[model samples]
Target: MTRALILFAHGARAATWAAPFERLRELTQARVPGVPVSLAFLELMEPRLPERVAELAAQGVTAVTVVPVFLGQGGHLLRDLPLIVEQLRLDHPGMAISVSGAVGEDPSVLAAMTDFCVAQL
Candidate 1:
C-alpha cells in the first residue's frame, strides 16, 4: 500500500504557530524519504482535516496514518478527530486510514519534554 503520514495539529489563531508545524513536516519528510507527509488543522487554520485528506487522496495515497500532534487526550483528540475520521471513512470507504495515538504520549516525547523543563528550571 502507498502509505503516508498526516500530522494533525490543533490550529492556532496566531499565524506564527504554523511555522513550527511546517518545520516539523519538513524534518519528518526528510527522515521518511518516500512517504509523503502533510499537516491538517483541527481549527482556526486553513486546509482543515478534510481538505488535507482530499489532497492525500489526489496523490493516490492508498493508506494514511494520522498522528495527532497533541499534548494530551483532550476534546479535539477524544471527540472531534474520530468524527472527522468517520466522515472521511464514509466519504472514501475504500481508502485505508489508520489513526495513531497522540504523539505526546510517546515515551521519547515525554522524556524530551522533561529535558526541556529541567533545562528551563
Candidate 2:
C-alpha cells in the first residue's frame, strides 16, 4: 500500500521559524526513501494539514501517518487535531489516516532534547 508521512507543525509568522522544520522534512525524506515525507502547518502558514492530506490522497497514498511536532499536548493537540482528523477521515473515505503523539513526548526524542539541554549546562 502506498504510504506517506506528514510532519505537522504549528506555523509561525516569521519565515525563519520554518527553516528547522524544512530541514527536518528533508532529513526524514532522505532516511525513509520512496515514501513521501512532507511538512504541514496548523495556522499562520500556507498548505495546512487538510490541503496537504488532500494532495496525498489524490496522489493515491492509501495510508498516511501524521506526526505532531508540537512540544506539548495542549488544546491544539488535544482538541483541534482530533476534530481535524475526523473531518479529514470523512473527506477521504478510502484513505487510512492516523495521528501520532507529539514528537517532543517520544522517549527517544525527549532524551535527545534532554541531551541538548544538558550540553548547554
Candidate achieving the largest TM-score: 2
Error of 1 at 25 (Å): 0.7
- Distance from true position, residue 53, model 1, in Å? 0.8
Query: Cα RMSDs of all predictions?
Result: 0.9, 0.8
Off by over 4 Å in 1: none
lDDT of 1 by residue, 1-121 (tens): 7889999999999999999889999999999999998899999998898898888888788899999989899999989999999999998776798999998999999999999999997
Candidate 1 worst ten-residue window by lDDT: 53-62
TM-score of 2: 0.97
Going through the candidates in order, what is the number of backbone clashes in each? 0, 0
Give candidate 2's error at residue 27 in angstroms. 0.8
Q: Which candidate gets the maximum lDDT versus the true structure?
A: 2
TM-scores for every predicted model: 0.96, 0.97
Q: For residue 6, give model 2's deviation from the true position in Å.
A: 0.4
